[model samples]
Target: MYECYLTFRSITPCQQAQRYLTGQSLRSQLLRTPKSIAFKGCGYSLKLNDTAIGLAAAKLRQANISYGSAYRIYSDGRVEELYL
Candidate 1:
């Protein structure tokens, strides 16, 4: 399975983005942003399958919901930043 993490500046937009993605038929999980890449301080993140990454990001943009950054979680436990 592939996983992606999308960080948000705050909890509000993070929750909004998760709800928006759910409405669009993409499944996501709300979780605390990884400490290593948390925005400014600690924050929230939407964890979803890699297959939904592009669509999720696009939909979030279309809905005007802002997010900070994205990262891909490797099976081997490495986390790399994503440009989406």
Candidate 2:
């Protein structure tokens, strides 16, 4: 499985924010695989293709998606954040 790193100032799960992650705005969806990824109560996540990580974050940020950054999370637990 491919992994991505994402940072958030807050992980407190606001209603709208949560919905956004699951919404149709992007083909990506929130990470449901608990062991694979973690999402704080009020934060947002985007699970897109590994290669699209850069473009996804960029386009999302350009669209005003609230997030600190996004990255690739390897099986070894290494995380690489890409700033949008």
Candidate 3:
């Protein structure tokens, strides 16, 4: 399964990440699609549609947000970074 992990460059006081997220948080807009052979992250990973990754990245950038990277795992069990 292909997984997208998003980690902040410098996450401070880990607890801050929790306080920042509350009722109806901004992350609520993020959605995951299982039909695309993707897996949702445990905590911070934002599961997005592979085809829409670019659009999502753009929106994130416009919102002053950043993501770690994108991973593509092939049927042969080879995983690599892919462009959006």
Candidate 1: pairs in clash: none
Question: Candidate 3: global Cα-lDDT?
Answer: 0.43
TM-score of 1: 0.87
Using all chains and alpha carbons, the TM-scores for the candidates as numbered come to 0.87, 0.53, 0.45
Q: Give the residue spans of candidate 2 off by over 4 A.
A: 5-26, 32-42
Per-residue CA lDDT of candidate 2, range 1-84, in tens?
556645444444322343554453544555433333444544445556676566655654565756655667777776655555
Order of candidate numbers by TM-score, starting with the best: 1, 2, 3
Which 10-residue window of candidate 2 scores lowest in summed lDDT? 9-18
- Point out where model 3 deviates above 4 Å: 1-43
Cα lDDT tens digits, model 3, 1-78, are 564433333334122332333221434123232223334332244444455455655555555555555555555666
Between candidates 1 and 3, which one is better according to TM-score? 1
lDDT score of residue 5 within candidate 3:
30
Task: State which candidate, 2 or 3, has the greater TM-score.
Answer: 2
User: How many times do residue backbones clash in model 1?
Assistant: 0
Clashing residue pairs in candidate 2 (N, C-alpha, C atoms within 3 angstroms): 3-73, 4-73, 5-71, 11-42, 12-42, 13-41, 13-42, 13-43
Candidate with maximal TM-score: 1
Query: Candidate 1's C-alpha lDDT?
Result: 0.86
Reference-based lDDT, residue 38, model 3: 39
Q: How many collisions per candidate?
A: 0, 8, 0
